[model samples]
Target: MVIVSVVGGISLLLLVFLWSIKRGQKTVRAFVFLSAVADGNSVESANELAKRIDLFAASELQKKAMIMVEMVFGGSQLKLISHARREGFDQ
Candidate 1:
């Protein structure tokens, strides 16, 4: 009975560990999708994204995605300002 209980406890811990890893992967995938959208390019398929995600650390992937988003936002803001200037809105 003691052996069975030990095995069951270990199994539970292993399952929890696997769950956390899967959750982290989903978070990374979401970040990658956001970056892809911000860049206005074709979004990667799930398998492609999963493969790419596996290549980098989760934190690294998140950081790169955020930088991509920031750049896209910055560029769009500049373009808006340029358009406003062309329309003489500043005056």
Candidate 2:
């Protein structure tokens, strides 16, 4: 029973890890697509965005990517701008 529970817990954790990676990839792709649109270039595809996301998903910019993804998808830009102002990003 103990061994089974241990194995189940580990399996759950692994599933969660894989889910997070997939979610992060989706967020990164959305961010890239939005950025490309804002830059007036409509040539990017889903595969290209996926490749870019994979490249940065495990890098040091993961945190930044998460922040941007949240800002864009969560509609937190105004809040973030206010927070940044208070935190001195304006400086």
Candidate 3:
């Protein structure tokens, strides 16, 4: 009985850990999407991007979320900008 309970507890913890990882991956993907929005010329101003970020981010995490989005964008700025330019030219 005790062994069974221990196994069950460990299984529950593993499941919770897996769920948390999945949630984190989703958040990262959202940050990447926001990064693309930030880099795109379609947004007229930083304020507009901020508003969109505010909508996507939780109130408490707005600043951190913005930083992450910026990091994703800034880190890939060359590639992203080139891709954007290429798309624009193609269009």
Which sections of candidate 3 miss by over 4 Å?
41-91
- The lDDT values for all models are 0.52, 0.53, 0.48
Ranking by lDDT: 2, 1, 3
Most TM-score-accurate candidate = 2
Which 10 consecutive positions of candidate 3 have the poorest summed lDDT? 82-91
On the 0 to 100 scale, the lDDT of residue 91 in model 3 is 12
Q: Kindly provide the TM-score of model 1 when superposed on the true structure, using C-alpha atoms.
A: 0.54
Cα TM-score per model: 0.54, 0.59, 0.46
- Name the better of 1 and 2 by lDDT: 2
Alpha-carbon shift of residue 15 in model 3 (angstroms): 0.3
| Model 1 CA deviation exceeding 4 Å by range | 44-50, 62-91
- Off-target runs (Cα >4 Å) in candidate 2 are 43-50, 55-61, 75-91
lDDT tens digits, residue span 1-91, model 1: 9999999999999999988666555545555544444455444443354346663566567555445435654524334334323433221
Residue-by-residue lDDT tens digits, candidate 3, 6-59: 999999999999786544433443444445455764433422433343323534
lDDT of 2 by residue, 1-91 (tens): 9999999999999999988776555445554454454565544443354346564553544566567748554754444434433432221
